[model samples]
Target: MNFKGILLFISLGSSFILSFFLYRQWSLTNWFDALFLIGLLLIMVYCVMVLIEGQFFTAFLKSTRNFFAKVNKKDQLIRESEKRSVEPLDYRKEFPNRSSFLQVGLFFCIGSLLISSALHYLN
Candidate 1:
């Protein structure tokens, strides 16, 4: 299978396994609860994946560095030094499959929600 398909399968399988363990060992009480928990977990994963895809951490670091440089009265020097340095690494080129996390997280979230809804309606 392709990377996206593999990611989706792994996410779905892991979510099921995790939810099953929670239902068995914790106070989940039912498959519905477990599925709901899986939905939440997958949603969190989706958000984190989105952040990563957006390069939020990189931007945050850049802003923090600027803030510190400004506080030190060396913003211009820092900017000039950065311009003279080698080009920053292209993360997308380095990790070409990283974007697949967004789709996998989304698919897992939606699947968990749908299953949980069905369980709710059936019971």
Candidate 2:
């Protein structure tokens, strides 16, 4: 398996193990609760991963800086000078294959929801 596939396997396994322990600790009789919680957790992680991959915060900061720069011409000049001195960092290099994370999270979430629904009806 490729590196991403291995990582995905590890993440899914860890999440299941963690949720299983949590389920036992909480004294829950139903497996549905554990699965549901795992699904939600994975989905949330996927959302965070996507946000970081997209550099949403960096864009937000740039816009905020621009707004402040417009309000003060002096500050804008200083900001321009700083920008010229600094090189733009490639943030994408830090996180590769973000779609894999999204897919894994969604798969777990949807699978859990379906299983929970089945269990609910069966019970």
Candidate 3:
């Protein structure tokens, strides 16, 4: 129930409705055109999601890396008495409740498409 979920629902639902209308109105005249339009809409959605996901993950990883890098030891210990080891970043553990919304958004898109297809078939 995040913003991405709401937006995806609206976007997918609108496209599905528009596709249905095209199918009903012009399908007989140019069935391939209707199909092509629907396919293009789906592809566009897929590409947008991919781009968003890529940018989100890339920025997330970079920030995490930078956070660790900023705290890193710049100088090595030359003397045993001055030895101080910088702790390694524990990225092996997952961030609490992080990026769950993005996955939920992806699921929302899938669910919307399935529901739209079901309704379309019923009609």
Per-model lDDT: 0.60, 0.64, 0.50
Model 3, 88: alpha-carbon shift in Å?
19
State the lDDT at 19 in candidate 2.
60
Tens digits of lDDT, candidate 2, 1-123: 876587567765666576667755532234445555655666677688777767878877666666765788786688787785323444562556666666666766677678777767888
Question: So what's the TM-score on candidate 1?
Answer: 0.49
Candidate 3 Cα RMSD after full superposition onto the native fold (Å): 9.9
Candidate 3 structure, TM-score to reference: 0.28
Candidate 1 RMSD computed on C-alpha atoms after optimal superposition onto the true structure: 5.4
Better of 1 and 2 by TM-score: 2
- What candidate 1 gets wrong by more than 4 Å, as runs, is 25-55, 58-95
Best by lDDT: 2
Each prediction's total of clashing residue pairs, residues at least 3 apart in sequence or on different chains, is 0, 0, 0
Tens-digit per-residue lDDT, 1-123, candidate 3: 975556456654555566567666534223333433444555565555656544646657767766665555453323224664444334333333334434544454555556557667888
**Candidate 3, residue 105: lDDT:** 45
For model 1, residues 20-102, the per-residue Cα lDDT tens digits are 67656543235445544554555566567667767768867666665665677465577677775323544431346655765
Model 3, residue 114: displacement in angstroms?
26
* Superior by lDDT: candidate 2 or candidate 3: 2
- Ranked candidates, highest lDDT first: 2, 1, 3
